[model samples]
Target chain A: MTLELVVTLIIAAAMFGTGIYGALSQTNLVMIMMGIELILAAALLNLVAFWRYLHPDAIEAQMFVLIVMTVMAVEMAVGFAVAITRFRSRGSVEMEEAQELKG
Target chain B: MSVQVIFLLAFGLAAVWFGIVVFRTHSMVRSALALLFSQTAVGAMFLVMQAEFLGVLQIMMMATEMSIMAIFMVMFMMDPGGLGEMDMKHQRKLSLWAGIIAFGGASGLALFGDWGPIATQIPDAGEQVRLLGIELLGRSMLIFESAGLTILTAMIAATSIAVQPPHRPKETPDKSKEPYQVHNHGGAA
Candidate 1:
């Protein structure tokens, strides 16, 4: 296998591991956010790697990624806004506490 | 060794990592994060398959969406400060059985899957862009422009709704004003 593929594989592996660890181990909301960010970074890395290696001609995917980035920015802003309102209503961000009505 | 073997190895390792993360983490946020990572690695596989457009979209959509969701959950959940211990609820036998079933199913699928032929000609990013523009907006400039306008309008609306004055009503100037007075009555003994 080429070195590029090797490195890409390694990175992908590390990303998956980190994502799993973050998802399984931490209960804090912010830590979970960090874990999500790490996973996203890993996925982006995969995209760039594949773009460089496979489709040297296709620019469509790159543009799509850009659009996705814009969408993500909007989503993050909206999400944070919603979160702020929720925090105002309730004083905590713990997931366990949210199980007040699990009928 | 063949490139296919290497790629397969990467996929396997990444998948295993994803499984481990999903199994180990108790928080929903962490699980989402693990899902994001797993999705991204799949995006890379898309690239390898010569689907550049799909690959990029996968990363952008999956990663960004997951991040936003995580943040939203963090902020809007019962605790804003994340200052409390979480109760980990486990139905022990169910969890173990679920894990076994998932692992077995995944392994079975992986072992039997048939990947199609490797794409011979992968287009460049620029060529793909040109094709996409033409395909999406062929003789339809007005529609595209209108879509852009709609987006602008949405942006304005969202901003107006999200941005608010940072002071409480009581903190602002009090509208009502009256003279303070104390009434006293003398009692005869």
Candidate 2:
């Protein structure tokens, strides 16, 4: 409930909102992934803020942050790999034409 | 406000601004780089908040990750340079409304929620790092190992997916058979 904590939380929330907008609005697969990255970044910001302001002695929060970072790296790798495969097969990475799974 | 709070606000603003820039730019490469700057600003905020190890790790990891992302942006994007001036988004009004609602809801929660007691005493950077290391190796060892395994699996899967299959040679027609061989055993000729 400190000023700093509130400010940090608000900033995280703003990033989260922006991320949602980008992810939902972008037509490209990579752009959507970028939005997801921003969302994850916002989560990381919140985690670190909570650890610093509420439970400074709990180091588990830091470990959680590291795991989240690893997730981000893994996500980027897998997403780009999928993008490359899609590009090779379809000649473009736009998501609008990816309707093979439509039921 | 304390110096730490001032620095925190400054970095926070930078992060938010660059994050907005990520979606606002037309060029894919610029968007990627803007995301990088935004994440770096978040790391700087971590530093301002006195989480030195996490801050350093964030900056270093994001630097390399975002560079690779930028390269991929150039490779996969149809208009990486923004020369085409194509609109890259869809459902703009819906997204805008969703974003506004999300921001308002989250801001309300942050402002009105009761976050109990704040801890004023924080460990120094070195001590925090040591404690984090111990936590990772001690109680959270299983989680750490699982994450490592997951990353390894993801790497292998990505590499396999990205690799092209070998091209097979075309089969040649067999020439051993007699051409137009017709057996006529009738007595008439």
Candidate 3:
């Protein structure tokens, strides 16, 4: 593999690792969402990298990446709404302490 | 050195650096911001690979989404400043081990795999943009529309739920209780 590809891969891996860490580590609801967003970005990195590597000729990968972007926007809107509801109802946003649905 | 190699190295190093920052930080907003930078770097790498469409998409989506996340952090989260340290209770060791394994496996793959040369030589980069536009509007039309609706719904839901109802003051005393003599005295005054 070329050095450039190697570097890209390394970055992508780091993004992935950090994303997982964020998603898993933070207890605050917003923090967890941020972590999830990071993970999504990491996954997008992998997609874009592969797109550049093998599909330079076709625009398919690029188009697909755009779709992912739209999805991300939608996710943020919905996620924030859910978080707001939780905050309003319970007066807190910490995921660890939320047990309204627990049996 | 080839342009691809140079672009890859720059983007890769930036991503890793930002990624590390994201992991190390306790603040959610900072982590989100770090992730945004890392995404941008990765997008740059995509441009190097000549996948202009994906690269642009990466920047637009990743950056905007992260910004929205920051907004949510301010509005909903009790501590808008993210002043306190994150609750890192059980998964620290597990996350570390998983991260290490993932990194090692990725590095090994990178070392061994010979990613072939760029698939096509573009005589006109402009045409690629037109083609990408066609693809997005044509093949991905439904997906795009749905995404718009989803965002709209989320906006509505968040605003409706987050805002508290205005408190209405009770004007009348309970019928079970006698009227206060203070009210009659106040009327005389």
Candidate numbers, best lDDT first, in rank order = 2, 3, 1
Interface RMSD of 3: 2.8
Q: Tell me which of candidates 1 and 3 scores higher on TM-score.
A: 3
lDDT of 2: 0.89
lDDT of 1 by residue, B1-189 (tens): 568557746764675466456435556567557666766766666565455676677767777766666555554443333434445433445534544454344334334444223334556656675766774466444655554655566566556555654673535545586533434455342
Count of steric clashes across candidates, in order: 21, 0, 0
Q: Order the candidates by DockQ, highest first.
A: 2, 3, 1
lDDT string for model 2 (B1-189, tens) is 878788988999999999999888888788899999999999999999899999999999999999999889888875634545767788999998898888888878888888877678999999998998899999999999899999999999999998775573554757886454344679477
lDDT per residue, candidate 2, A2-103, as tens digits?
888888999999999999999989988999999999999999999999999999988999999999999998999899999998898888778877888456
The candidate scoring highest on lDDT is: 2
Pairs clashing within candidate 2: none
**Estimated TM-score per prediction?**
0.44, 0.90, 0.76
lDDT of each: 0.52, 0.89, 0.68
Candidate 3 per-residue lDDT, tens place, A1-103, comes to 4455566667767667666766666667766665666666666766666666566565676666666666666666666777777776676677667776556
* DockQ of each two-chain model: 0.13, 0.68, 0.57
